[model samples]
Target: MLSEKSMELSRKIIILIYGRAFSFILSLIIPLVLTRLLVKDDYGSYQQLIMIYAIVQAILLFGMPQSLLYYFPRKEISDRSLLIKQTWSILAISGLLVITLFGITSQTMESIFPDHHLQPFIFLLGIYIGIMLSVMPLQNLLILEDKETTAMWSMICFTVIDIIILPSAAWYNPTTLGMVHGIILTSIIKFVIVIFYIYKNYLSKLETRESYYQEQLAYGIPVGLTAMIYVININIDKYMVGLFFSSSVFAVYYLGSLWAPMFGWITQSASQVVIPRMSKAHNNNDLLQIRELYANSVEKLAFIFLPATVLLALIAKPLILTLFTDNYEDTVPIFSIYLLLLPTYALNLGWILMASGQTKFLLRLAMFMSIINIILSYGFLTTLEGDNRLLGIPFATVAVTWISTIVVMYKSLNTLESTLSESYHWKKMVTIGAISALSAIPIIALLSLELENKIFLISSIVIYGITFLFTSFKFNILNDNEINLVKSFLPFKN
Candidate 1:
């Protein structure tokens, strides 16, 4: 039987899974509908708008949002309220400065994007950014407070709001501005929901703590810087493509790099839940608990994502064609290369550094990694244009991710005073990788025959999924505890 702690963790994980699932499904629909509704150039413009918002928000929020996970669970309730107040103050102040700067340098900002309309949308984007930065801490607070069900419900509500508003907005205006309008409204609704809940349940008189503010900023600044660089790590390629290539080209590149949300959902769900737990353990100086949490989290992420990524890779071409239409057939290789990121996702060692508050090391790693990623991606793009151009971004991503994961692994072990062999289940992950590969044999065999695209895709998914799950279960890829945790959520008993 599982311990009480394990059961609680499992319950939190389930709520997070639900949240991610809701967000993931909603995410898929918005992109799919937008891609189909708008022209390729327009779609590309919208993506660029989102990319800009992401970069700005990463800067605006700094690391204040992450500090919630680090400090909330450990802090007294009064201090938690003060922390929230201070974090929001930072976001509002910083947002004002940035928005003002953006308004003043509107021309400079416009020059970065390929479209003139995107320049004006910057205002809406700025407002959305401010709202988002404000709302972020509240969302993380829910997770920290272990209000996972409430968090999940909030996400579901937001999804419902987006689904109803965005498609209609896209259908009517069908332009970048329309999309921005829809997004702004969506953010407003969510902001109100989260803030109202926090205020009703958690907020109190402003309890100012200067030392707490300093501590959060000290820890958060480096994490924020790391995140800012991570923006470069992930989005620099798109920026490069958008800057050099045309809007239409960027659209294809963007679509190609669209990772199935399943990979993100699994890893993100694990990270969000694991971080608070690990932070609590680290605060208590519980080394054994930390070790178990780290190892178990990685294994679960791998067991869930490894097979799904492999299946996606095998059907990358047809999948892209089916989702985005044959116009994006050029996205096949890009999507295929992007699929390679799955294995690397299994090496989520960042949680160790994050929970341990070794954030400066994370900043250093991101700095070095981002520089290398930019250079490699640029070198490839310049050298290989045309059909081979999109390949550069994913190739750079894969290489950089592998290198960063290795470094993080080494640093994580060093931080934990453990070794590679003893610390992580390396052999298990490798075995799972092999299992995922071998399980694709049937799908590969199916590819040899001529069949309808839908039939081929369906057969590949069904065949590959059954094989992977059967192998995982038969080989006991998941431990008894994990199997039980999963079974608890199912209708039937284990």
Candidate 2:
């Protein structure tokens, strides 16, 4: 039975990863094509629109999704339907607040942009905010409920729709608003599908009541606050950038941020399932399952993040060139600095902190993190005028970010010992890190030889990646289950 459970867990993890890979590929293709098709100014407006959407999304969900992700995974969900209804109630309240604030601030936002009357567009976006609020937490339920195949396939199918429709919209009339229209239309379609799936597959049978709503609110609010704080920590940098930098420079920073920070999604996806899975694992007083989950999550990321960040730093030029037209030179160095976050974020999840049932404390700790990020960003963007100095702002901010996260994580690690193994996985990870770094020697050599074109850079990257994977898997550095999880995707490996 234990073997079967492990197998099931492993299988689910693989399916989720594969689904994300498919979605990610299509995601890349659409963005890459659109970036090429749209001019810098058009792309800049589109990106700004996205930033506005992100902020709106954050507030619209009323942080209910974070609460859902936190508690829904537990085996002790005595009244699932009631909890779900309560979450929806919270969402309703929060969504209204966000829209109201947007109303008051709409004109000021347009003034800041200096080129667009964001009010109409923000209003268009406001209508869907409630729908979006449901979808994200519903996604949380799908993953927690182990509806992997449904969720995975659904996302891929949506991306396929996006891939076809978005570029078509651009081709017919490649204006900035046209592109935005295409994206919204596509997202609305996906949202409809998700709502349908969530109800049909999971939420339909749950009972709803007032008591459960109150109980979940009592528990979920702290988790939601933690989520908001974490978001504040991460998004605050971008917010500061928009304030202090030129619109053009803000555009460059936005584009460069496209890759490195979102790479943390690798961690996010695994932890999305991991949190619920770990929460369900009988870690009440025992540490084995918790340790297994934490160590495995951390270790898997080491292989992913270390080289990617280093290589991203090396390949920023080609990446930006390949993804965007060569209208901008600022993204490369700025992205190189931003790429430093790859390793730091990969190592610890806010979920690990969640799994230990320290939501309030984590929220407190996140306050410190947000404080640090704000102060550093202010220093770089304003006090020191680092944004004007090209990559200097990102560089300074990245340094501060890494230091702060490391200090906080190390402090958090001791508490996680209940969930993480006593083993020195970090040490083993370092050894693998060494091997991965060694594999990159060739790429460094190529760089020195001034092989600057896209092909050489991309080819060198492929070589280094293969070399690193070979080194890690050939020895016992990655055990059978870890290797098999990766292999499950490959036709031959199966």
Best by lDDT: 1
User: Residues 1-494, candidate 2, lDDT per residue (tens digit)?
Assistant: 12556656666766766777778877888777766777665666667777766656754564566666656755355566656766766776765676666665665667776555344466545544544565567556677676777667766887798899889888876867687678767767866776676567446877544465565665566666666666666667667766655566667777776666666657667777777766656356555676676676677677678877667666677777766668656677667777777887666565656666666776677677778777776766655543454455566557656776665566556765532245337776787778877887878778777665777667887988888877877766766776665565454121
Candidate 1 stretches with Cα past 4 Å from truth are 1-4, 107-117, 205-211, 260-262, 479-483, 490-494
Model 1 C-alpha lDDT per residue in residues 145-173, reported as the tens digit of each score: 76777677766777788888998999999
Error of 1 at 113 (Å): 10
TM-score of 1: 0.93
Which runs of model 2 end up more than 4 angstroms from their true locations?
A: 1-8, 75-78, 107-117, 171-173, 202-210, 281-283, 383-388, 417-423, 448-452, 479-481, 489-494
Clashing pairs in 2: 290-419, 291-419, 291-420
Positional deviation of 327 in candidate 2, in angstroms?
1.5
Alpha carbon deviation, residue 53, candidate 2 (Å): 2.5
Which run of 10 residues does model 1 get worst, by summed lDDT?
Answer: 485-494
- Inter-residue clash pairs, candidate 1: none
